[model samples]
Each structure stands twice: as C-alpha cells, then as structure tokens.
Target: MTAWGVVRTAFGDHDVPSTLMGVTVLGYDGQLVEIEATAAVLDS
Candidate 1:
C-alpha cells in the first residue's frame, strides 16, 4: 500500500512551511510490517 499526507501546525501562520510525506508498506508478516517514507518541506 502507498499513501501521501501533509502535516500542519495550528499556529495559523501563513508563512509556515508545509511538510509533505509519501509512505509505502513494503512488506508485512502476521505481526510485523515494514514501512518506508520520504518527506519534503516547501516554503510558503
């Protein structure tokens, strides 16, 4: 599975940078799963 998301703070600052993430589930067992993620920041 794969997913994407954005993280934001509640400070209400327009200039606040944006954090974007991409995640993927590479492998899974009955009780464990491996995950990989990458993140980037964009200036606002």
Candidate 2:
C-alpha cells in the first residue's frame, strides 16, 4: 500500500490511538506492525 493509503487506514481504524500531531511509518514489511506518531511530541 502507498504511504497515504497506510495513513488513511490507520486514521480510519483508529490505529493512531490518540490525536497525533504527525505520523511516520517506515520499513518494508509485508504485514503491518509498527506505527509511530508525534502525538506525545506535540503534547510537549
């Protein structure tokens, strides 16, 4: 899936967990595993 596609899926499925200032997912994996967001950073 494209980057935006992942973003959309994450947001739609509430995978983000909380309101995030930003999100960045990397690595080439067949299955979805890790999701990193800037929500905590933004809370600073």
Candidate 3:
C-alpha cells in the first residue's frame, strides 16, 4: 500500500468536489513524495 502522512490544510481548487489538502509520502532511500488529498480520505 502507498504510505501517506503529514496532512495539512491548504488551498483547494474550486473544481474539486471535496476539500483539498496537502500530504507527504515517504519513499525508499530518503526520497519524499508529495500529493494533494481530498477531504474524503484524510483520515482513512
């Protein structure tokens, strides 16, 4: 499964249905991944 973390409130695009937020993802070899998450699964 893809790991996710460091969720925080951020600017959201009006086109999206749910609230938008920022998140950090961890990768192997000290690499980091970032993505925009919707309020639908912020805690799931």
Candidate 4:
C-alpha cells in the first residue's frame, strides 16, 4: 500500500505514529479511502 507507506513515512517524520505504534483502520467513503489512526498513534 503505497498510500499507507507515504502516510507512515510522513507520520514518522512528524513523530506522529508508525505502523508499529498505530492501528490504521481503512474505510471506504464513496470513491475515496479514509484512514483513521487511533490512540496508538501516540507513543505511550
């Protein structure tokens, strides 16, 4: 998933969250893909 990779990379740079820490819930809204990162995004 290139899109997911990009998001992961960007988040990694911003210290937001990576796949290791966050749970990505991908949802389809019509023709667009919506990504929702939960609380796991925050390293605790």
Q: lDDT values of the candidates? A: 0.45, 0.59, 0.43, 0.59
Q: Give one digit per residue, the lDDT tens place, for model 3 in 1-44.
A: 22222222243333434444454655556776556654554664
Write candidate 1's Cα lDDT for 1-44 as tens digits. Answer: 22222222333444444444454653555556455667566798
1-44: candidate 4 lDDT, tens digit per residue:
77678777766756553554443653554455457856634466
Clashes of 4: 0
* lDDT by residue for model 2 (1-44), tens: 96667788767955554443443754665557656646544453
Model 2 / residue 8 / CA error / Å: 0.3
The window of 10 residues in a row where model 3 has the poorest summed lDDT is 1-10
Displacement of residue 9 (Cα, Å) in model 1 is 15
Q: Who is ahead in TM-score, 1 or 3? A: 1
Clashing pairs in 2: none
Residue 2 shift from truth in candidate 3, angstroms:
12
Report how far residue 2 has shifted in candidate 4, in Å.
0.5
Residue 35, candidate 1: alpha-carbon lDDT:
58
TM-score of each: 0.27, 0.31, 0.20, 0.26
What TM-score would you give candidate 3 relative to the actual structure? Answer: 0.20
RMSD of each: 8.2, 10.5, 12.3, 8.5
